[model samples]
Target: MPWGEIKDTAAERRMFQRRTLVMLGVAVLLLGVLIGRMYQLQVTEHDTYRTLSDKNRVQVQSVPPTRGLIYDRNGVLLAENRPVFSVTLVPERVAGMDATLEKLQQLLSISEEDLDRFRRRLREPRRPYQELPLRYDLTEGEIARLAVHRHELPGVEVAAELVRYYPHGELTAHALGYVGRINRQELQRIDPVNYAGSNYIGKTGIEAFYEEVLHGKVGYQHVETNARGRTLRVLERQNPVPGEDLQLHLDIRLQQLAHELLDGRRGAIVAIDPNTGGLLALASVPGFDANLFVTGIGVQAYRELRDSHDKPLFNRALGGQYPPASTVKPMMAIAALDSGVIGRHETIWDPGYFQLTKGGHRYRDWKRGGHGWVDLIKAVAESCDTYFYDVAVRMGVDVIHEYLDQFGFGRNDALDVRGARSGLLPSPDWKRGAHSQPWYPGDTVNMGIGQGFMLATPLQLATATAVIANDGVWRQPRLLKDVVGDTPLDEVLPKATRDNVILKNPDDWNFVTKSMIEVMHGRRGSARRASVGASYTMAGKSGTAQVFSLGQDEEYNAEEIEERLRDHALFVGFAPVVDPQIVVSVIIENGGGGSSAAAPVVRALFDAWLEGFADEETGAELAAAGSAGESSG
Candidate 1:
């Protein structure tokens, strides 16, 4: 056989050509697939991948607005903001949260409470990469320490924010209140959009009442960051709107005087402008420093305040429910006169006591020797319990209840005052509802003396006295005098409804005013000594509320009882009687006599306000009164 014929050269060439064609076709398919995938990645899904990459380099942040400033009527700063440095952590960026927190604790003096609060916030639902505050108000040393160790930390940051500060410290604590770190409850209620970066919220008093107006709109910023999430530069920013400034009706001078007068005593004083219903001063002695509560108060510090006998944290001016005592005599006198139970010239005889029936229980008078024969004016001037007791019996309980109600005895409709208590005014129905007891004639006698279940707050007393000073025009008491912002005060706050307390005879107001005047200026007046050096004409009533009842034959000797068990001295007054300006109510807890303790305090306030802080025209009148010494005469 020939080798060329056996090899089949022609068929071998055809097989090689077929193999080459198949390999070239497979190569072409793979090239085409690679081109398609490259096109898809670079063109079709470009926006999606670019966005994902940019997220690692750029970040959007919420910019918190600055909180509002609080000022007194004279523009003295009450509450302001100060820059504070805080340590924060982003949980998602943190490599080992437990280890990081442990390191932070060692580096800075992180309290267990701080760590606990931090852990709570860390567990809460929040936006990814949001910084959570761990320790606030960092000292310079702590901040430097954190900076030194920044390279080793991944998510830890030293951030700066504005924190609330009270310049006056304990002086304006009760009135202005304080702002604190936002808590779980507040977070649930606050606007997430507006408060996105806000960490603090108002907790009480005016701060709490005007929270919305003080917390302005939030803003935003875009920043570029590196691999470690450190902000390199701001890409974009929207300036935040600062909160509105507040101007309170509080007179710092008068407020300071009230505190000085009440120093070393457990007491409260409230003063109001009769014409405007603006709060002039609200003072509760033994006040605690409000700044402590702003940045999270210590357990030990808070415990001391909570347990202290002085009750420094307690707001006594609007919350203290005390017996008004003879301070309400003028109001009761109005009731008596309006009911026709007594006339201006009505006289009552006292043998040191009065009985509802012959041989019944004798309601003893404050003066053991009795006031002798007393007319309506004399009774009011001397605070004769016997005269009130007789009129109370004759007018009955229902009439007394109706008349006193018109004077705001049992209610507080003051719009700006957030937590004023509605004092208890007892009636036949109230007695039955509260104690399941029937009304008795003796109860009316006790009510006439502002005793036995009649409770009133210092604010209520001031407001009622203001009504008298305004000549029966009932203006609800208020703390807010004006708003210094875009928002109208009425639109921002609830409207305070006004009404007139019209007496059957308008002369009744004049009659009561004159009687009150005599109480301060009359020779035999109970508060005559207190009025001796006053410049302007002041009308007032002094009272001693018994802390405990005396036996039928027992006499009250203040020296015999414990100081806390002694009577509470009280006084309510309005100055420049004809055209009254300020009305004041004061209570000295456990003080022996209203005339000696409370009246002196009132007189001092009246002098400070009328002589020291009054307008130019009013000051002239006060100067004339001081020179003439008509009050002394």
Candidate 2:
């Protein structure tokens, strides 16, 4: 204490005062800096920070537009959309996808198919924050379970969407097709921005043809979300534009009738309006329930359809390529008459078979014993193979090819009919390019009878028959009737794209039509039995296509051959000879004889079209279709 007290008292006081002043100065400098920073944050950058805060709570979402509805000519619902609840997940909002999926599985049932579809889609290109469906058409119990655990799982929601539903799935499966979930390949092909929030797309038939018109414009909305990524409210929204409705020429009653007529048979039926090329009915038997593919078909179920011996998926009306058989006789008659290969009263001698020369391969006729002497009308009515064989040789393959092409053979020119095959209309050039061989005389003879190298689809046959009914007018077949949109039906329908079959003699059409009528009502008409109860004039040609060729002298014995190896029965016809109400083509696979099998089928369909279905019968039939559900799965 004595040593410390030695310091000067004045010096100690001065030092304390200096230190206090220095501390005060430093404090004032720090206060100045803090004031500057406060000014910068509160005034200069206020908008930036406010925007950042809003972004954390708000989100922009895409709203998918409603798809179009499809109806038949009679206003029957062919394809419609039914509301379905689905479980969906937003990946970005999820804390941990693996953990969330595991938790979801524990709460409800999830099929391996749904999981596979989800996992596969997750790898595909998609818009930001898109919701992926985990399960579709959830059961009430599953929905309850999901609802109870909704708060436990983040980024999970139950969504309702209109899914494609076909009331008469089996009846219109091939004609109307069905929608399916978008896949990775489709993602690359479709417009990402436009298709945003849309799950399904048309896969085939008219659905695919009019997809652009059916899929309406997308919309947008700004929504406010909570801290937990749950949507609180919509801040702003643009209402989505619903797709336009479509009306088709397809008659639901006719479609059902066609399916019924083809029941228990493997075949196809194509009916069309001759005046306008609208299809009344297009049916392929052993059809599947298109709904199976809408959400997702089960693995086993798909395998069964793919491996079934019946080939239910095959579009026989548009795709089955068989020899046109004697169904082409009328067309050949026109070719022969117009080309001067034969006259209207052309005569030929038949002795049960045709010979190219004095001694050549004898092509046996359907009638083992022959029609003896026959004129053009009698030949066409009796389907005399000898008469056609002679004219085909004179006309040559090129002439035959040219005439057949004019009738829409060897190519698919229908404006809206999809999945049709361009059947072979063999010519010398085609033979050379395809088989690297010259067209043989026998090949030409076979073409005359719609065999050897000539093949056509049931649709093609129907169209050709329609040309006759329309009096040489060429109108491409179409399924679309009218669109309920800004665009009118005429604007939507393509203009005439083909030429009418003109002849040197305009009366040739009348002559050929008369000959075709003879094939139905003439005393020796092949299809006379089918025309027995007809109240109106009818014209038809029955045809039988051999599944296997016979030897020169081999006789056809239906009982001796396997049923599957029997001839394919075919018939093409149009009724009310004057106005020609409807044109139909029927093909039955392995159905023994044309007159016995296909002719009756055509007769029934024609009667339905002309006479119209009874109201009571239609109700009962529709009820049956609804009950059947068209779903084997």
Candidate 3:
């Protein structure tokens, strides 16, 4: 090797060594960058990636709380929770919803309606993995079939849920109401935070009125889940508070008794504890089964209920508005005495018809043959339309309207129950305001006998009867006694006015009560047939409100008219007149002659109540006069 060759070789070797060192450095730098990036992803965002992975494996779901129970005053269950197995679906978990549903239908009989509802629920904006109810109250056979094919279905699930049950069925349906599955309408209205895990909501009646107390507060669980959204473990849980129980004022025994008395009739019966204003029995005949509404009533069942001629869904006790008929006579008599329009003993001659001097309209009495000369007491006892016509002419509509309004007649009772209709109390002003019509003299005469534009609900009539029983003390009628596990009801119902009746003479109350007594015990009492063999004295007035007007020459022969076209029978009374404890109001639709139909029903109710009282009192006489005066004539 020459010296130049040695120098060039040395330079080449140095350059090769430098290039090797530079390559080694570049490789080390690339390796360090790769290691740093891997560590950053694995350690810094571990939780975010882990959650995503766990979601694909585990499924977590919300468990709705059980609804509260409802009981009658006697501890009989009205509304309760029953365990129900239901098929549910999670649309997000389903690969092909239509195909899955088709398979589901093949496994279990699924109607078009069920499929339609399921599809609708799927379309609604909801959180992923949230179960949508597909079918409720699945039979054991259906459950078994679904379980056998459980592996074929991924998104479908069967779960036990607490569904509302009404054991009494139709008997207590209107009062207890029912609960139904939560819907979009309810979702928007409900507090999402509170109802985060809730399934059902109160639809109507007492259930709806006290929903807050009945629906328990929602709870939360912090759960660990897998990539499939399956739950790994519950890290923390806050136990849910169960709903408080409800004890209503309704008496099941009396309620059943009243229901029996109505017996296939379309009407209403309301019985109240005169002393406490607690509703004993508020029964509307032709009631529906509340249980049908719980899990979701079928379209056919719902349509039948809605379209039925009997109107089984109608709540007549609280909602039916009808002319009070001659049941208003006792109140009118009291009003007349209080207004100083007629003396208690003042006699009004009845020629079977009343004619206003100015108005040529002849207001005919119920009796074609004259009731003849009758006083206020006799008029009320015999329910003489002519006599009341005379008193009404003297008292005028203003005086009657003012006095009746005070007694809750033609007024809303503002009952705790939802959908209570305030019946029309048509005065000259009310008529003018509502119908844009002037008051007529004939209207006053019609009102005198509980006819014309005068209307009242069974509840209002019962409440008014209670006030009359208490000597004008108008206690506010109440349905709910108290809510369990809560502060006592804060509302102090208004006291019955001590001086409700403006009658200066205290004897006036005595006189009217005496007249009512005669109506039951008197021989000529219109309700005489119903009051046969009465052990206790009852004060009542029978009323017959014409469904359609008959011409002056036309006689009201009930048999001649169609059954639906007949008059409405009304009866209002309080038992054991001396120390009245129960007040009853009954109305029978197109039942003809309050004395014949309505009064007999009331008499039966009184008999049942008085019989119970007699048993408790060891055969003590509830009323001093077993038989007072019988004067229907």
- List the candidate numbers ranked by TM-score, top first: 2, 1, 3
Ranked by lDDT, the better of candidates 2 and 3 is 2
The alpha-carbon lDDT assigned to residue 296 of candidate 2 equals 83
Best by TM-score: 2
Clashing pairs in 2: none
**Can you write out model 3's per-residue Cα lDDT over 287-361, one digit (the tens) per residue?**
998888876788899999999998999999999999998888888888898888888788988888889984677
Q: Residues 44-138, candidate 2, lDDT per residue (tens digit)?
A: 98888878888999988889999999999988888888999999998988889899988988987886777888888788877788899998888
* Candidate 1, 440-490: lDDT as tens digits: 888889999899899999999999989889889977877777778888877
Worst 10 residues of 2 by lDDT: 624-633
RMSD each, Å: 4.1, 4.8, 4.4
lDDT to native, each model: 0.85, 0.85, 0.79
Off by over 4 Å in 2: 1-42, 615-633
